[model samples]
Target: MHFEQANRATGRLVTTGEVGASGASDSELTTGRFDGQDGHGGEDGHGGKGGQGGQGGQDGRGDQPWFELWNVQQGLWLQHQLGESRADSNLPLWQHLHETLDLAAFRKAVSFLVDRHQALRLSFQDTADGPRQRVLPVHDLDVPLVDLTGLADPEAEVDRLIRIESATPFDDLGSPPVRVKIYRLASDHHCVFVNVHHIIADGTSMGILLRELLLCHRAFAAGEEPPLAPLPKTFEAFVQDRQQWLSGTQSKSMETYWLDQLAAPLPRLRIGDYEAPADDVVNETLEFWVEADITEGLGALAKELHVTLHILLLSAFVVALRDISSDDDIVVCVPFFGRDTKDLDGMVGNFVNPLSVRMKMSGSDAFDDVVRRARSASIGSYANSRYPFTRLLEQVDAEARPGRNPVFSSAFQFTRFLPPAKQTSQLDLCLYGRPDGERIKLRFNYNSRRLAESEIREVQSCFQAVLRRILGDAAISLDSLSEPLRQARRTMRAAPRDGRRLGRLRGSRSTTPDA
Candidate 1:
């Protein structure tokens, strides 16, 4: 409930501006005025001030030797190389504000931020002992403003620009891996786009950065200094803390837990009909909003069952996947937020860590049974949240084949995450759920190499149908759900791969058409 979000009159990338795109669907991209706090954030959500003089993050360049990267960081870094070379792991965030211009204030606020967070000035290098990272001194910030109000189609131009910017890679060595551009559609209307590499930030970092930017802009607009509190801890300090934690006993315990959880030959995801691509496949996204009725019932069920909404949704996802695969063992990769302590609450870095959650299913299992299994798996993973998935992969003796993941290929998360930008992923499928008031917004991204468009449509149809039934009555048997999924799979197997919509893959279940 205390999640950080953008204030009213704010929107992210390509969500249809006020100019000439009135006919566009809101579901094309994530656009809404998320509620938030004043002047950065507080202890309740975004990190608050506690440690004083932790300037190590802001001006700690060349002060000491380079530090080791977090296990996940190293994994992402290597993933960029070992595979068909990812274009760039960039996360784009944007906001639309209808207000008068104050360019001076905006620039100052950004400069103040550059001087405050060390991540804004990070540089990586391949050292003798592998890759190491260090914070560099504050450099020039790329805050450019473009006036598009004179264009015939300002909104359409904005959309095109977003796609181009999302595909562009960052120069991590020459300057900071961030670009802030202001698109002016009118005198009182503007769109702020900020693109940062995932190495330095995650979904949570967007909220923190936006809060700081707004707080600084407000203060400077009123002809006053920014009143943002000093960060309790710097990103560098958090990295150092993790270094020591990795060598401690708690870290060892988490490793043992993971080692036991994923023992022996791991299961590979085989839902898609096409063969896994030799290289990174062309990724595509299918986003839709769950029905208001289903959303209401799911919340009620969660409350009745004494579990969080995340557990409920994740349970439904597990059941849907299980029905399609008809496999007894289910492994879904779920990433957990890594802001474990207050010291890390405000720091902006790659703090999202992944957990390879495995669930065992039986034919006689009911909806409630799967919920309990999901709850247990979730709680256990949360307890051992520090264990890195990359480390687990190294310890697990799974086949190292290209294309499909040797371990779990499907991933699921119930968090405010970045929209699909690169259109490429190491995994075959990913489901992201973000809570929006009474309804839940879902984004399903799939690899074309592993799954055809029609096949993924079947997967989505199956999930919604099974979810509606589960919410209606938890006592329904899982054995009853497989017939629909199995039939859909058969239909997909027989359908031509000429790229046509597989409308109504399931027998009478309503499916949200491609957005």
Candidate 2:
């Protein structure tokens, strides 16, 4: 049976898969010879101006195609080259299928997906104009199938494969940014590993790719041609649109707003302080889930406050940071998926823009008042979110700080779209979620060099405490609540092993607030 679910962002019912259809069997899907080189010029049919032909300027290589880089892409590319230490941008999407699968149909489905999305076929090349993306023509990209079914330790081998794949950097100058591999543990169990560079895809792009890939797989397995929709806009078209928008009046106004908003010296969260300089900085994440009940309460509270759930959570986070840092000014880097236009919704590429949100919190303010302040700040930031972070930095004349990001040291994001996982007729497919679960996944990506894991945990605990207290009584003064809450915790611990106190303890423990 085909299952349909409403896309949280778009509210459109998306078809997960179709039950059965007849045309050609899975084995027959791969019968045709795939001539890797036989494809049309890279830019023939896509929207926007077709791909530029000749390489120009001293920076361009004669053999590679060149296209302009978006501001965010340029920033990331420069950081990858100039930063003393590099964090690998290669991201792996791993899935374990618990049923016997036809490799032929799977490969065909992946090829179909690659052909459909223009961004998947792109690589970056350094040019006189900075880094430019080059799009490759459709080819029979190889999906390596490794058989580990006979290995002495299959589990260890699986881990080894994952480690190697995750650590391997993508050859952005030469090869396409995506790699695929399949490992067979037994006739009925297999694991699929797909690694792609962050430059070419984001979480939303991955979801789009997985959904279409699964649809194609089911169609091919059931002896029918895949019924996937043509992309509404090409990645190149989106890039062109973005460039035009950035040069327009609206972008200038937005840029001005950011310059003023961030004019004050950026406030650093009191998570930790690392003075020594490190060549490379690696980020560590703390993963946790907010239970359905608390999540529901948050949603209700968001409605009552006339703000988004994200805004409410961010308000509590600001209060928590204030409590820890004792600094009234708190700035957080919040990620915005820069897909405001409907045309760019399904197109794959790096569309994430991290914008700084500055919120002023006072200990004496009421919880509701702080939430309103956060809401206003959030609304203003989001209204002008399309301005590129790199351009904003230049506009503000902000100097890069040693061992830290310039404007904001901390980041926050709440994602509703988890990784796509589904079951088909012959395969029990499972695409790994962010932290792998149904409840909202809150990932706190922090600089390991600056902030200790213990400090992050403390921040998490403080956020939870503040959120619960506010929910219990939104009218409470922020200053009065903190001490009383500490005292309440002490009283609860001292009261006894009675049911009432035990219930209170359970409530306290359940509030695993997102960072």
Candidate 3:
């Protein structure tokens, strides 16, 4: 049987095979089908240079005016006024490399990435008709390099610089929404930070960009041409195709499914001391990790029950929220990687769609039963997730809630992405992931004005405790859990008007959390 494995040292596909029943030869095994080609490759296993020039029409080089804002982009534009700070929509990725990087090659790589992906050079403008995306021509991008080697404490200076870059919002109207900064800590050690507006890039896009940047940098340092494949489709082409699909029968069917699924009014969970705070509420993040053993156990349970780890964990989250808030109906917004086609696999853009997964628990269902139900609900949502979330809100005519998301305030996401392996020989990259003995890293981002830090930590502890209990016995009832968990539920259920149930609520309670 033929199989493929990625050569971590060189980010290339290598084909190998096990002895098959037919006794295929070694040569045959090594010459098996290679699925990495973009279909625009020549017969000699090299990519064709057909679309290198200005290929008019759908190639995104035609005389088309400003591109229409994608459904999600339009929604973000409409709600831009509601954000507390520009950083609210900023997505920053920082990397610590153990070796010195070639500054010139790194800058060229960044420019190469910008030239390859049109989305990185996108700018938004408001016209007489509506907001549109302007695809700017590719040009040289100067990656800002800060030499902090002479600072008293270079590491602290790097931290300060990261905070500044993260907090500074991109001017989407005036310039490209992506920024790259490199901080040199020593002759060989460096820190790289890349920040992009969430409207233009998603988690997957960051990975794509990093992989290409490393590839280009390595090639440049070696005085060789970059071995990057041509993208089968551009983000602009994706936008056009998506619009066409949204006008098709399949989109109509998806819309119908979403409409029925979201017909009922969403139930809000009041777990914290206060109600949902306004859009301007300050947000904070609490980070924790689930041990490898518990994570392994959860995976075993999920596999045994024929459910995904996401559903299993989501079920636990719902149970915990129910115990804390006494809410039977729960809705948690989950973001899915929106690249559904092979053509879009290597493309970069805001290809993330958040779907509100609602679960109605009786506060008495068994853990296994909840997992099963959640699996079913999640599968249904995934099927229709191609529909724009903004369109769903408009179709359902969801009412605006001042301080919370239109339908749900709380959000849950299981980001199972593995960062691309570093290919540059010069840099020893340290990518973000669970530590040596950890299984899952949990980041809790919540509005500090609505939920106290203590309350958030308590919620994390309770979630961990509940997850352990469920893994121990999937048949256990939610109400039959330990007293602390049960008491948490009761406290949230009967929260007093003074906002002291979870803790002392301190912000203006008129607004709600962002969706």
Q: Estimate each model's TM-score.
A: 0.80, 0.74, 0.77
Give per-residue CA lDDT, model 2, range 1-515, as digits (tens). 12122112211001011112223221221121212211222232422223321210011123435678775667557656674222255556666777777889989888877776767777777777767887666545789899999998886899787878866876443467788888999999888777776667765676676677667877888888777544555676567666776777877888899888998566644435434253445455666666666677777887888776667777777777666555678777655556655445667777767666798765568888988787666656666666777667776755566444667655554445432221110100111113224245564555555545655555666677776787788877867766654443333233322222212211111112311
Error of 3 at 392 (Å): 0.8
- What is the TM-score ranking, best to worst? 1, 3, 2
Model 3, CA-based lDDT: 0.62
Q: Each model's C-alpha lDDT?
A: 0.65, 0.58, 0.62
In the range 1-515, model 3's lDDT, one tens digit per residue, is: 11011112111101111122233322232222213421232211112222443311113343434778776677556655454355656667777777769989898778778877777878787789888886776445678889999989999999888878877876454467888888999999888788777677766677677667777887888887688767766666667667777777878987898788777675655656444445446546667788889888987887788766666778888777665555677777654465655666677777656566788876467878888788666656665666777677776756666644566666565544422222211111011123334578766666666666666666766687787888778999765764657454344343343436553332222121210
As a whole number from 0 to 100, the lDDT of residue 209 in candidate 2 is 65
Best-performing candidate as measured by TM-score? 1
Better of 2 and 3 by TM-score: 3
lDDT of 1 by residue, 1-515 (tens): 12222311111100111111333222211221111211232221123343333222344333534777775677656665564344346667677778876888888788778767777877777789988887765567868999999999997898789768866876443356878888898889877788777677776677788778877888889998777667766666667656666677767877898888888766655566434354657778888788788888888888787777777788888877766654567888765555655555677777666666799876678888888778776666655665556666778778777655666778776755434434456677888788877788987878886677777776777788777778667878877666655664555444655553333222221221210
Per-prediction RMSD in angstroms? 9.9, 12.8, 10.3
TM-score attained by model 2: 0.74
- The positional error of residue 450 in candidate 1, measured at the CA in angstroms, is 1.3
Candidate 3, number of clashes: 10
Local error of candidate 2 at residue 112 (angstroms)? 2.3
